[model samples]
Target: MTPIFRRLLLVVFACGLPLMAVRAADPAPPPPAFQEGKEYGKLTTPMPPMVAGKPEVIEFFSYNCPHCHDLEPTAQEWLKRKPNDVQFIRVPVSFNPSWEVTSRAYYVAESLGVLEKMHRPLFEAIHRDKRSLASEDEVAALFVENGVDEAAFRKAYKSFQTETQMRRANQLVQRYGVRGVPMLVVNGQYDVRSPRMFEVVDFLLAR
Candidate 1:
């Protein structure tokens, strides 16, 4: 063979070796159960009061949760790919009294029909923008600046509806036995938490 042709074949084989190995290799097996605890379920299913027919992907997260903020895109992409098949729900938990601001802020965003608009920005307010979204006034200002009418936001922030939603959040947290933010409950039954969180979900979905 010509020198150039021989060199080209060598380069092609080198590039294809890894691809061939990958295709020939068996995938890694799932990890053994470890994070499984008292409330954890095996082959679990979501609870009722759930919207029927739609599979639910509930994210139990707080605005102050840096991990949740980081995973937002992956979670968002998951939702987008299955919009019609899955119902995505965000449950904000108060890791402390200080985190209560996050719960209020979430509903306030929902009320304004801006969860999509403010979700990441709210995360940024704490993680990136270095802003305090810890108060109704501050959050309201954010809404106003973002073109959500301040008066409307203020009214909703103080609204009984928002308060009711907050109470509901507490109840759901208790029901799911969720102790941390950014935990995902698939169909309200199986909770994905700690080390294997996303991995567990991938396993559950694969099944």
Candidate 2:
């Protein structure tokens, strides 16, 4: 090759180095047999103590995150189609100020035992209505607008138990290394995103 052609080839080779390394790296292996790992069996995490003997699949979601909002329908569908042994949970991130308010709102709803009613509204309020359900007054107003009694909302919103649950959720975020919202963790054993998600679920389920 000519000297000019040799230099051009060197440039191309340098640019391709990262791609070669990426190809060299081993891809994640296929999903394992179900009932084989703790992530698949007798699911229990210390924080909040989700139901044991029942497998858990978690969607680490954040209200301020548009992607998470988009995943809502898929998550709801999964919840509907989930097996009897699988218990689904949504954990809202609390590491940032913008996300903290939404996390608190989730706890408030859980305390009221009205998750079924408020879950969609909360997401719609922030993502669709452009409302910020931040303060007690705002959350209380949201509750009133959604047919929940205002007084009841306030009572549960600031209750000690509700706050504790919120804190516990924060702990879970750290434990799970949940860097991104809308990430899926199956039975706390594996975190899945994109291509490998459902494949891993099926792999574990077959066992």
Candidate 3:
């Protein structure tokens, strides 16, 4: 071949090789693994919200539930990193008369502004320490140990506001048709199950 043609051919071959290599190196992004209905189910009748505008992420749990105790750490970690727009709410489930006391403890702690302090300890006291926090008095003692005054806890536990919150929580739980503890409800629409709990939540949020 002529010198000019040979040089042109070499330049074209060098340029073509890089283009081919780039095409081979890049791959398509993998699709999301979470699926609707399988990973999460929608609430048959969407429950009404306690607030407007901000999306709600509710954790329906009970102090007496062993499974809820097991999931506490994961839920806490997720709380630290959850999206700013999301409002994380904890609703204590009252499955029966016995669970009502534990439910009251949640609202009382929230009303007294001690939920952040008492939340984990309440779980630990019940599951880790094997304490029986079944009665109002027993739960108030745990609150006292957590820095809340016994008198204040007693007053807040039976306050009109605390009772209203407790009633609303129970109403929502029934509306959602939640059957178990540690269940996640995303934006009042999706019921997220564990193992892939946060993953499904992240997916629903993206939608």
Candidate 4:
């Protein structure tokens, strides 16, 4: 090889070595810390805790909401790691008649003791399968197909207990002033707005 060409190759390699070393030594940027009005917001008036002596975290969501469907997996992961002292609750928001139908269906699943089995599938049924759960018959059929007794499903769907839970859910929605689905309210005082919702909730729980 020519002397000039060999020298040039060595010079380039020498320069690249330090550059690569610097890149390898650089630390990753830290995650964003929770901030008021950005990561989360303080409620105008904090609501009373649903579970006494335990911090409460409520997720306001709608079954028909595509965003809520998207967040289900991440939420489930967070639930698995969340503090046992914290009481986590899911409140289905009914912004309209159709959503109210789904909200009632949620309570029916809860009442029939099928929520653990039905939750993810229900989200999939609406969002993944693109099926219609907009009516009582459709909701009942889905539950029955998933191993619930058809008679019991219908009974709970119309029973006073489910109706009471639905009313309470609506009350919490109004009190929280929730206008969007997939919202996380921490300790009834902070409404988490950031995409890194669980991190903010962890911060609030620590505080």
Candidate 5:
């Protein structure tokens, strides 16, 4: 080849070396840490999230369940760092009459706009303090102690709206196939069962 032609060839090869190095340096993405039918199970039919345009993370728990109580701290820690795009919800499961009472209490607090204030106390009452909140009188007393008016607490405790929410909670428990407490469902698609559940949740959210 002529000197000009050889110079042109050298220029093209020099330009191509950096491009080839970049291609070789690019790393492949790591495989997913969790797996289907192992750490988590996908719903046969995925349900749409209650809140539109945002991912939902639901915790199906019961005040009467010791395991649920044990998970409270970890759940709260995860909530503190949960994605801003996530809409978290807690559904109190009622598998028996006693559980139904606490479920009603949860909805009552929700209706009165005191759920955040009462959630931890209720859990502590049942699990830590060994207090029994199995009756309306007992639960109402606790509400009163928390600065809620006795009359208003009683009214909301037995209100139709609270009952409706309790029913909805039950429906969600059934729909999600939640057979146990301290269960986490991601965007109504996967039911997480691993100990590293929040990790699985982060994985699903990234997906």
Candidate 6:
């Protein structure tokens, strides 16, 4: 074969082979199961926690919300395996005046250093046991039963710090534009709302 002719034939064969391979190749894999703005959303104004250098995972919840109660177990389990760099914060939202009492109760427990002991039990008391813990007195009684001093519980429930935290939580809800309970905010930027909430958070963290 002439040199020029052989060169042109080889080039044509190489180009044709690629086209054939392309035709035989499998289809592209389906898109990811999670879709931005559908399963989750970006916060226009991210309310990242003041904790420096750590990615924040905030759970916007309300004690009165049954969905939050349902999510408590799943959240606790996810915490066991969460990345070390991520700091999880649970913000009790006050949707209205009626919810303010429960919001206060959460911070109160936190202030008295009883949150670790009282968190899940409070959920069980209200949800599983069908107890009406909607008022300050009712909530305080539950705390007292949990071994916290009744007076200390009452003082903390109405303390300046607890009130401030409640106000800040409400402001954050408005800032994050969180419309519902049991919503997970990853690094204060991404709003995740799915049963696979922690999965989405882990994906964001990895990214």
TM-scores for all candidates: the values are: 0.74, 0.71, 0.82, 0.83, 0.85, 0.85
Off by over 4 Å in 2: 1-50, 195-203
Q: Each model's RMSD to truth, in Å?
A: 12.2, 15.1, 5.2, 11.3, 3.6, 3.0
Q: Which candidate would rank higher by TM-score, 2 or 5?
A: 5
Better candidate by lDDT, 4 or 5: 4
Question: What lDDT, from 0 to 1, does candidate 6 have?
Answer: 0.83
Candidate 1's TM-score reads 0.74
Task: Give model 1's clash tally.
Answer: 2
- Residue 30 in candidate 5 has what lDDT? 84
True-structure Cα RMSD, model 4:
11.3
Model 2: residue 19 alpha-carbon error in angstroms: 51
For candidate 3, write residues 1-207 as lDDT tens digits: 999988877887877764234445668789767776678887787766558878888999998999999888888788889889899888899998768998999888888887889888988998899998889889988988878999998898889998899889888887888798889998888898648688778888889
lDDT of 1 by residue, 1-207 (tens): 999988877887878763234555787888654445632354334476378876777788888888888888777666655647667788899878768977888898898898888777788889998888777778877777777888888888889999999999999888877876778877656776555565566555545
Best by lDDT: 4
- Cα lDDT tens digits, model 2, 1-207, are 899988877887878763234555788897644333432333344333278766777778877788878878866666676687777777888767767777877888887888889888888888899997666677678878888988887787778987888888888888777677777776566666553444456565444
TM-score, cand. 2: 0.71
Q: Show model 3 residue runs off by greater than 4 Å.
A: 1-31
**Given candidate 5, what's the lDDT at residue 51?**
94
Task: For residue 202, give model 6's deviation from the true position in Å.
Answer: 2.1
- Which pairs of residues clash in candidate 2, taking residues 3 or more apart in a chain or in different chains? none
Quality of model 5 by C-alpha lDDT? 0.88
Residues 1-207 of candidate 6: C-alpha lDDT, one tens digit per residue = 899988877887877764234555788999876778777778787665659778888888987889998878788898999878778888888888757887888898889888998888788887789898878888888998889999999888878898789889888888888788888888777888667887888877777
| CA-lDDT, candidates in order | 0.76, 0.72, 0.85, 0.90, 0.88, 0.83
